[model samples]
Target: MASNQASNNTQQESKFTLSMNHDMEQQQICLDHQQVEEKEFDYSKRSQWLRAAVLGANDGLVSTASLMMGIGAVKKDIKVMILTGFAGLVAGACSMAIGEFVSVYSQLDIEVAQMKRDNKRSNKIKGNNEDEKNVLPNPAQAAAASALAFSVGAIVPLLAASFIRDYKVRIGAVVAAVTIALMVFGWLGAVLGKAPAIKSSARVLFGGWLAMAITYGLTKLIGSSGL
Candidate 1:
């Protein structure tokens, strides 16, 4: 009888241990799922800053180079060319900053307005609304993006002027730099904007080239007129 009682006690202990082990396994699975969800939601602000910095440096190099080239093409004096380059760098950086800020702010405003509209629509159609919250760009993200864009746009030209020597080479370098930067920016915009990469890249490139061309033509005409 004692042996039988001992066997029954052993069976109960085994069942209890098995149940505890199962619970532990279930808990571990839950923890893993939670970790994965957190990982999936992660976004890095530093990465955006790094991208902007690279873009800014590139912009600085290109714009300064282009201005120097255009001026050098007209004016043979090294002093005049350098001075013009310096001026262009400062002006370009400021222009880039302001332009970026304004453009980003405008977009941000539009997005906010859009989100508000969406919310109202969602409320009106409660049953039909299928988690539209995931579709909108976070406000924080837009702000970060804007800040990065402006910062990069402003800093590059200024730094480029400091490094480059030959006015014409600087100009060529600037053109190359700007072209590359535009391409990169386009890609970035497309990724962030969640749009077609090729289309976005083309748009950015076109705008950049148009600005450069206008500047080049105007400067040339003015230089030729002896003005």
Candidate 2:
């Protein structure tokens, strides 16, 4: 009876050990699944759009504002400033759109060509199994984003100038408006890209100020020279 009891205990321990191991494996699998799901959830993936949009907007704000301010220094006429600003807005937007489209399309073409070469090389070898590589870049979408962003940035300074009468006041308003818009844009870009907002905002603001100041100074020098 004692020997039978010992055998029964041994069987029970074996069964318990197997059951515990099975439970542990199930728990491990569950944990792995959860980890994979969590990894797939990412908020920073929107940087692709933010990258192009922010750059376009920054260029629009700085370039259009600088142009108008340069002309404003020499000519205080509101119509001239408005006309110059409007022309810059249109030209800059078009340029940005075309440039972005071409650049993105060129990159896409190169990638496609490389992918084809890789596919050919892979097929020449025996018993090689590689995942198919496909890449598509939307040039139209990028162009549209750039154009729209440029218009948005350019309109702010123009609107500010339109409301003011004095050249000095207009210049001040344009500078202030561009600076604030740039700061906001930089902050928004930083937030979207998961970067430091303060640093980004400060850098963009300074760059914009320097651009407008330099342009205004040059125009003043030229004006004084009667050129």
lDDT tens digits, residue span 35-89, model 1: 9876555435445554555455446545665566567667756677667766765
Give each model's clash number. 6, 0
Worst 10 residues of 1 by lDDT: 128-137
The lDDT of each candidate is: 0.65, 0.88
Scanning candidate 2 in windows of ten residues, the lowest lDDT window is 126-135
Task: Evaluate model 2: give its lDDT.
Answer: 0.88
lDDT of 2 by residue, 1-227 (tens): 99999999999999999999999999999999998776545544566777888998999999999999999989999999999999999999999999989998997789778867876877644333233332367788888999999999999889999978887889889988998999999999998777899999999999999999999999999999986
Runs of candidate 1 with Cα error greater than 4 angstroms are: 44-53, 69-78, 118-227
CA shift at 20, candidate 1, in angstroms? Answer: 3.6
| Candidate 2 lDDT for residue 177 | 94
Work out candidate 1's RMSD over C-alphas: 8.4
**Local distance difference test, candidate 1:** 0.65
